[model samples]
Target: MATFDSFFSKRTLIGLALGQFVSLVITSTAFSSSELSRRGISVPTSQSFLNYVLLAIVYGGFLVYKRKRSLQIKWYFYLMLAVADVEANFLVVKAYQYTSLTSVMLLDCWSIPSVILLTWLFLNTKYRFRKFVGVAVCVAGLVLVVFSDVHSRDRGKGLPHFKYGSGGSDPVKGDVLVLSGAMLYAVSNVSEEFIVKKGGRVELMAMLGLFGAVVGSCQMYPEILANI
Candidate 1:
């Protein structure tokens, strides 16, 4: 029998938390977008902006209560992080305006390879041959999916509920947006990995929430004013 501390170690807890966080984020994003679509409300950018605000509020409050300390990163580095993070969310959410969820799901895995390459180049991390093979496999799978989508699209059965008018609903444009968003997300994740690993930063989640809140709110200001 294992001891309680051994079973519930910090690493184990962190892993569990990370799994839960990823699942929650994915589920929430899918649910929110699907529900909004059902209601004919196309405001993914606005929703994405608000998500950051809520995260900032919740994490910032927690940080203040737990540590009561301010974060101190260089302005330029922080600016890069904020821009990458904000653009990642904004672009992905906005992609939904022009593309189907299926295409988004297939393309968003772009971050896996991007992060692997980034870590290898910037962080001097080395991986086994098997890992490289795994990446190649993933790429091959993605290529197949793309080809299939293209075939179906040519057959006039690509994506359902697709609408094109003055409103945004171009599948090609949406695919491009999703790919761009995925690449941006890769940049943000790579930057975060560098900051946390190389820069020896702690309380990363809190910092992200706070910065996201600030950046997201700033972007959303015009929309807020227009709505008001």
Candidate 2:
């Protein structure tokens, strides 16, 4: 009875609700990216560019209203963070061009282990035995997913079949892109968490929004030109 009550506690329920909301948003983004790829449109950077712009406008407005004399964190640090964030978004969205949505979502779990290691090494975070067990389970699941993909490819004899998006797309390449993006996501998440804890959420968001928009814009320019 106590365990059940704790599991369904108000805070726990709220957390679960928030988690589901985030999951829905992420799934929707993946679906949109896949749909665009199906229609032969692959502007991954452009898709994320507007989001950064919105963040800049909203949070940056708050900072301007507060009228702080100087930023708590250095501008260059945010620049690096934004670069990682932009590349992470780019790679994950781009993965939809060559992989199944299911595979992209599953392989994106690679960020869990990456985040664990990053926090431990950079932030000196300590984990309990249960946390390690959880991470181990996640890794095992990822291994099984990879094995299944490889087995499927073997059975198909390396022929390009319509598994997900467009025909002739390579799932392996997409998986690699997702994993790479996941690593960058881990880096960005850890750094952002640390900075936010030390500084202020408003400042962090404003700077990230500012730098992310610039970085995303720089990358999207070439993409736009290529598409044109």
Candidate 3:
């Protein structure tokens, strides 16, 4: 292993910074095309930031490598992460097709309850009633947000802008899908937290990153090939 001085050397930081910059540029460009190809899904840049966070995970794994812990990777946890990642993205995109961002985000409030239960069940994590109250307060705020959005939409030139069944879609169902996706995400988070407590985050994350990529690729490749 490198000495602390060497690991924290100016040369090391410079290299890391340069590598991050290059990675950011590459991922930005690649996903830009992916976004366009999927249709004009103009996601809020801020919200989409996490979508590109896999790169950071990859970098973190490398840091673990430098620390020279264990390099062996598990594939199962990675598979779960990959499935969760793709499902969440798919849910968000499909929700956008049916509902307003406001309603979708409101329903994502489901994550709070889902995650709390997840922690209690899997991690044995606990919280006071006050914490539950805090979650309730946040959920109420989310409801208000959706109400405001719906009101604004109703006042606009077109209200209930989407349809229910054929051709187009419905808003309420979109909210449900968002909630489902959020629940899945919470499950993934809790699962990873459990995994982290048991194993090294670096190796686990690297494995998860690679596994998710492969799983997502398998799901996507058939569709792409069918299109061609």
Candidate 4:
């Protein structure tokens, strides 16, 4: 009871509110991405590329001004992290082209379990039994979500834009993409956590922005050329 009461602390409530706000922002972005796809504009890489540029200009500039401090981690590590982050963002957004926003959001929860496993395996993190129970619950929820999508399709109630087995929009393919992207997101999140703990938030964001911009630009240019 005391442990539960601690969660009601003002600081904790503030943290919870901030986290919820971030979640809402992310959901809003997902809706925007889906709307873009619905409009026949599917430039997932381009979208991420612009965000990376802004991050680079904002955070990267801070790092440049603080020239006294050098990077704590190696550049190659940030390069790998940037690639994973960029690809994860691209895959999740691209999935908007093939699935309902609801399914995409629900399936993205796969990242929770992926993160738990990665942190346990690579970071030597340990969890209590309740954490496992939470994970099991999440898995059950995901199973039900997939089953619901399948049932909807079988009943011909799936979205008109996403017909099962169709080349243009396959829900199964989109789900797979979301799961793949979630796994990559786990990798990026774990790596970022490790780097931030060792170095600092500024260093992590600066390097991530710099490398992410470069990687995003490389992927974006080809996508633009293909569209043209």
The local distance difference test score of each candidate is 0.70, 0.86, 0.62, 0.86
Clashing pairs in 3: 82-212
Backbone collision count in every prediction? Answer: 0, 0, 1, 0
lDDT of 3 by residue, 65-132 (tens): 57665544455666777678667666655566556544664566678888998899877897999999
Question: Which regions of candidate 3 fall more than 4 Å away from where they truly are?
Answer: 1-57, 60-74, 141-169, 222-228
Model 4: ten consecutive residues of lowest lDDT? 159-168
The TM-score measured for candidate 1 stands at: 0.75
Write one digit per residue (lDDT tens) for candidate 1, span 85-148. Answer: 8877777776666656767777788778888988888878899999999999988877765565
Clash count, candidate 1:
0
Which ten contiguous residues of candidate 3 have the minimum total lDDT? Answer: 161-170
- Model 3 C-alpha RMSD vs. true structure (Å) is 9.4
lDDT of 4 at 138: 97
Span of ten consecutive residues with least summed lDDT in model 1: 159-168
Candidate 4 lDDT tens digits, 111-157: 99999999999999999999999999999998887776655656555
Checking candidate 1 for backbone clashes, the offending pairs are none
lDDT of 2 by residue, 103-144 (tens): 889889999999999999999999999999999999899787
Ordered list by TM-score, greatest first: 2, 4, 1, 3
Q: What lDDT would candidate 2 get against the real structure?
A: 0.86
